[model samples]
Each structure stands twice: as C-alpha cells, then as structure tokens.
Target: MLRVMTPTAVLLLAALPALAQPAHLQPTRDVSVTYRMNAPAAGGAPAAPQEMRMAFSVSEGKQRIDPPGNMGWMLIDRKANTAVMVMDAQRATMAMPPATVGAMTQGVPPGATFTRKGTATVAGLACTEWDVTAGQGRGTSCITEDGVLLRAVTTPPNGTPMTVMEATQVTYAPVEATRLTVPQGYSPMAMPGGAGTTPAR
Candidate 1:
C-alpha cells in the first residue's frame, strides 16, 4: 500500500516556534505533543478512518516530527529555514527546497486571517479557538497560550473540512539536541514528486 505523511504534516512543520510572529505559532519552550491523526486509507478505497499516533518534539529553534509506527522522522530548523525528511526504512534523506521551506516556516499561509472564536480544552490543556481563513481554505484551530496546537480542522479550496490532528497527550519537557540532527550515515536522495497522498482529509 502507498503511504502518506501525517495529515497535518505541512501545518505541523510550519507551526513550529519562530523568531518573529504576531501570534505564537509554536511552543515557546521545550515540549512534545502526541496526536491522533485520522485520514482515509491509501488507494482511495472506502475504509474506516485510519488512526495513527505522531509525536512532535520542539526545543530551541528546532523541531522534529516522528511519524507513525517509527517509519522515520523530519527535522526542521527554524533559524536556518530548512527541512529534511529522514526515512529509516530506506536509510535516505530528502531535503526540501529553500522556497518551500521559507513559505511553510511563516506559520500561517500568506495573507491568512485569524478571528478569535472562543476557548476550549484538549488533552488537559486549555487553548483558544480561532477561525482561520486563507485563500479559499477555511478552518478552525485550538491553540494553547504557549502556541501548542491542540486541534485543527482544515477545508481545502474545494473540499470538505476534516479533523487533521487532535492532541491525545501533551508533555512539557526538555528535548535532547541530538534528536534533531540528521542521522550520520543516511545518504542524500532526490525528493520524490508527490511522494505522499492526501487521502480523505
């Protein structure tokens, strides 16, 4: 079966702590969030919602995303404006282009507007709800004061809204620096075009 990155991969990567932003897009301190991701099964077959556990680690100006089932991880450097995907099964790394990295690191889509909705709690953490609008996409997000995203529902330009990510657990702890570095021996590989799927989300 074909595989896909976590449903909110782009958003999660773009939302990491940044040096400048009117609103905090990521946690201000070291932290980790485990999310329950729901998306359609690969191959476009109608099936039960696939649930996966993805852990996000953030500290200093770096962020790491550990995808489900230990497939591999992605490391993003906020200061350097770069991102690289580490595939353990293939023992290779795919680096994103600088243009793509720069756009995603902005936290929100260009010209995106946020309207305060209310407040809610998820995974024992309190967060404020915000209605987000950018281009033809619309969605809602629940974010904590320190900039942790607890829940997110996104509607693409002409698609149904889906709950891409929801927090199952949250922990505020220091993350080791080594976890954010690329593996020493992984060889570089050309990034595959459309390497992942969108599924039903």
Candidate 2:
C-alpha cells in the first residue's frame, strides 16, 4: 500500500533552506526563484525531475516563503526567531520557534565542517561553492554573494548521488506585504507539545 504524506511533511520537504545565510550573505531585496530537483532512481528507469517555485520577501530581519502549488507558505521572523507554517487547505497554522525550524532545515548537520571550494554563477547570480562533509555523508552547495543557495548536490557514503537541486529562474522585485501574512479566515492550531500559537490574520 502507498502511504500518503501529511501537509506538514510536504511543506518541510518542499521548504528546503535555500536562503539560510550568514551576515554577509543576507538578501538585500525581495526575490523569486524557480528550482528543479533531480533524484536518482533506485532501480530501473530514471525518474522525472520535480519543480518548485519559491518567493522570498525580506523586511527588517523577517523573511517569508510562498511555496509552489498552494502547499501553503511559511514566515520566518529573524528578530523574533520564530517560524509560522500556514496550511490553507486545512485552514490551520502552526507556529514553531527557531530551534525547531533550525533542526528541520539545517544543511550541515552537527559535527560537520564546511569549506569554500570556489565560485560559480547560477541564474545570473554569482555564487561561491562549498564542500561539506559530515560523518560518511558529503555534499556541495553553490551560494550567491548575497547568501541565496543556487544549487546543491548530496551523496551518502557508498551510495549513488542522492539528489540535485538547482535554481533555474530568478527575479528581483518587491513582494506585497499581504503575501507575508497569514490569509484571513485560517484558524490557529495548537502545536504538538503545546509550544506556542500565532493567530491567523
């Protein structure tokens, strides 16, 4: 039997941390990016690549993500160090602190070292490449000067290339303020373990 994924799981998987950054790489303006992911097949014929569109609107240390295909969106408030997941189809929103979201989206796992390899360009943006190794796993990422991740490839020890994610399109423009907030009429859902709550707009 095939198992179906929860909306939360889909959101987490789709919400790859493409924009996680250090101080120098912080985005200076709002932007939209279209990403394509190619996953290696375990056996038989190759699988088709998956596509996702993401939008980031930045303001005062806060960033919001509008994911593709109505899977809903997420809001990350750096100042508050919190993240809000909005599920429109369910009309429910879940709030999480930075630590929780960090665990879900962190690229380099603990006890890993990252090294800058060189630089390259993607979707008209110049980026620096980094090599990361953690335990038996290894990966590479191409990040822009402003800290946007343009491409990533990862492999497990003794395993074939796992996945490749790349940005294919990028545009810089102002994101409407409304896009960053929860849409009206959604209900706040209590987080598992009773973490906290954020009322819907």
Candidate 3:
C-alpha cells in the first residue's frame, strides 16, 4: 500500500537542514521567492518537476503565505497565536491554534544532525551551506543571511534519486494587505487533525 505523506512529514524531510534558524538572521522585510522543485517518481519512473511562488510578509509578528496556483493561502498571527488556512477552490477557511502550527514547523526528526559546510551564492544572494544527516538519509541546504532558504537537496535512505528545491527568483517588496486578507463569503471549517501541523504544502 502507498503511504500518503502528511504535511508535517513533508516539511520535516524538506527542511531538515534549516530546522534551527539563527535568531539574528530573521527576516525583517516582506519578500517574494520562486522555487523549482524536482522529486523522484514514487514508482521508480523519471523525476517530475514543479514550480511554486511564495510570499512572506512579516509585520507585528504576523506572516502570510500565498501558495502556488489557486491552492489557497495561509495567515499566521503570532500575537494572537492563531493560524488560518484558506482554500481558494472551495472558498473555505480552517483555523488552527498556535500549538498545532508550532508542532508542524518546529518538530525535528530524531537522529538528525546538521553541520555547516561552507558558503555559496544563489539567486544573487550569499548563503551558508549546511549538510544534514538523519538516519541513513542525507541532505544539504543553502540558506541566506536573513534565514531564507535558497536551495535544498535530499537523498533518501532507500536509495532513490535525490529531490531538490532551488530558488529561481527573489525580490524584496512590501506585501499588500489585500493579498493577506481572507475573502468574504468563504465558509469556515474545522482544521484537519494533521493539516495544521506543518506549514509546508
């Protein structure tokens, strides 16, 4: 049987190398980035690639993420300690508490270790390279000084080909308030038990 990966699991696998962000490097401005993701086919076929655009606007401890396509968007209010997920297609919104969001983004896999390798430049930004190892799997990530991830590659323990996410574009701009607002007439729904556990996907 094929096991469906939860959002939390996906986030952990994708961001293991950058799990511990340096406090001094947190971003202070709104930014937008585009990334290309390549993943090995589950049934051993050729890899498939996808692209996504993400926007991060931080002000007064609030942040919003507008996912690729029309999938939806998410708003995180740190001061209020709440998160809301808006489903664009269905016009539905789900609410999650701070604890759930924390668990999703901050949980580190067991036996995972990270080591700073060196530095590199990506998308015209200087970044520090870090090597990560967990169990029998290995991965590497290049992160910018402001805690932005520029690239990541992971080779699973089962020996499948590596999966990668690379930033293709980066821009600093003020995020419009309208982009972060939940539209009216959207129905409210309960958050899935596992959905809010991760900020990825």
Models, CA RMSD each: 6.0, 4.5, 5.0
Worst lDDT 10-window in candidate 1: 192-201
Superposed model 1: Cα runs more than 4 Å off:
1-8, 16-23, 42-59, 107-110, 156-160, 192-201
Candidate 1 residues 5-108, lDDT tens each? 43254544355222222256677767777777654457544445433333335535777777555656767777767777677788677676666667557754
Output the lDDT of residue 91, model 2. 82
Number of the top lDDT candidate: 1
lDDT of 3 by residue, 1-201 (tens): 212222332343223423634332335667777777676567756665766655656674555654434456666555555567777777777766555566434445677787888889888898887777767767777777776777777776676546467788989988777666778777776554644343311
The alpha-carbon deviation from the true structure for residue 152 of candidate 3, after best TM-score superposition, in angstroms, is 1.9
Which pairs of residues collide in model 3?
A: 104-197
Q: Give the candidate number with the greatest TM-score.
A: 1
Model 2 regions lying over 4 Å from their true place:
1-23, 40-46, 66-69, 104-111, 134-137, 191-196, 199-201
Better of 1 and 3 by lDDT: 1
TM-scores, all models, native as reference: 0.77, 0.72, 0.72
Candidate 3 segments whose C-alpha is farther than 4 A from its true place: 1-18, 21-25, 66-69, 78-81, 96-100, 104-112, 133-138, 159-161, 191-201
